[model samples]
Target: MPSRWIATFDEPALVAQALTALADLGVPGTRLVSPAPYRAVHLTGQPGPWRAMGWLVLGGGLCGLATAIALEVGTSLAHPMHVGGQPVIAWVQFGVIMFEMTMLGAGLTNFLAMIVLGAWSRRQVAKAARDGLRSDRLTLAIPTSGRSPEQLQAIRAALVGATGIEEAP
Candidate 1:
């Protein structure tokens, strides 16, 4: 038996209907591939890692800010260059370094988070592309590896009007 089933549909309505039907069948790992985003199809799943990413970025920025403060204050105190009645540690001048470090930290954290979180979707989209998915059509990939014969038959019945049905690679 194939590991997965692929169904292609030209009409958005059919794809939407097929998605709902698959959901009703309790099919897991059902993915939709479309040339453009469709308003009709709603994806309901766990919230993405974006919230965690935001927190991570905030932490990274705070760490960077702390590092910058330490560097500026420590170096100033250690060197102790009292220039023309100015204080040993100048808080106003440290703003540039603090801002730069904070931005650097947040940007790096954001990049790493994006790479890690986006990998799975990237692989799925690449698989869809390799399967001859077209820009003018919508494709649905349904995992069928653990499904019983009857369940497979029911899935096929649900997608009766699909333009094409094939075993996904």
Candidate 2:
């Protein structure tokens, strides 16, 4: 596979144009790497904000529920002390534990989710070298496999001054 790269404007139109160009060029596999996220880029797959948060909320909610049940179960098993002649499932006390568990789990889950998704992780800073970049710079890179010479020529022509053509494993 012949890996290729391109640098485009930080705006959405240019990013879309670059992606469209790659698609139009009939590249086999393509990807976009950016200093900051491009909203439209990741709409199709994982590592986006909504997906990360959705999983975090779902997992955290399940964990919270489980924690509530576990707490109630362990307490019931270890010390079956009755207060006010209440039943084993004391609603008020359980409610407090549930609320605390939900908030704690949700917050920690979200925090870990962001970190896992490479939100604030370190990248090779020197890679994003260009002039007149905006607050967020988006770079699109595409990898081509088993291409004909004509196709490679076409891609090479398209990437006139673009840089950063490294292959990923």
Candidate 3:
């Protein structure tokens, strides 16, 4: 399959137009790369499929809370202990530990998810020219797989004056 096609834009309006043009052309995997967050370019179609992270974090937090309760209550019940004449299953004392564990679980899950998704990978650097996405440049990328030559020509024609139009790896 063909890789990605990158079209660089200097203005946000151009990026928006290019996005609309590509979407109208039925281009798949269309995306934008910018130096910083900008609201001008409104993407079409469904967003990226990363919504699972929220569910993953929630599951992790719940598991952490359950584990915390089991450890604190189960240990107290297994070997009854008394400290300061308080209840053996000290709910108040366990609050801090439960909070810490819940946070730890969510944080660790987020970190691992990012790693798995290649969010920290250095490979993306090699795809474009140096500072291509920095210093007032916005890039619109579309994967060229299964696209006809006519479609590719149409995309090239749509992105007039693009800084770069190349097959991205």
Best by lDDT: 1
Give me the runs in candidate 2 sitting further than 4 Å from their true place.
Answer: 6-10, 43-57, 80-85, 117-136, 156-169
Please, what are the lDDT tens digits per residue for candidate 2 over residues 40-107? 46521224355558777779877987898798878786888877888776777788778888878888
Q: How many clashing pairs in candidate 3? A: 0
State the lDDT of candidate 1 residue by residue for 2-96, as single tens digits.
78887888888888888778878888677777777684336523245566888988988888888899999999988999887878887877889
**Native-referenced Cα lDDT, model 1:** 0.78
Would you list the clashing residue pairs of candidate 2?
A: none
Cα-based lDDT at residue 117, candidate 1: 79
Q: Where's the lowest-lDDT run of ten residues in candidate 1?
A: 39-48
lDDT of candidate 3 over 92-145, digit per residue (tens): 999998998888888888778767755633344336633366867887767777
Candidate 1 residue 103 Cα shift, in angstroms, is 2.6
Root-mean-square deviation of candidate 2: 5.5
TM-score on alpha carbons, each prediction: 0.71, 0.60, 0.72
Tell me the TM-score of model 3. 0.72
Steric overlap count per candidate: 0, 0, 0
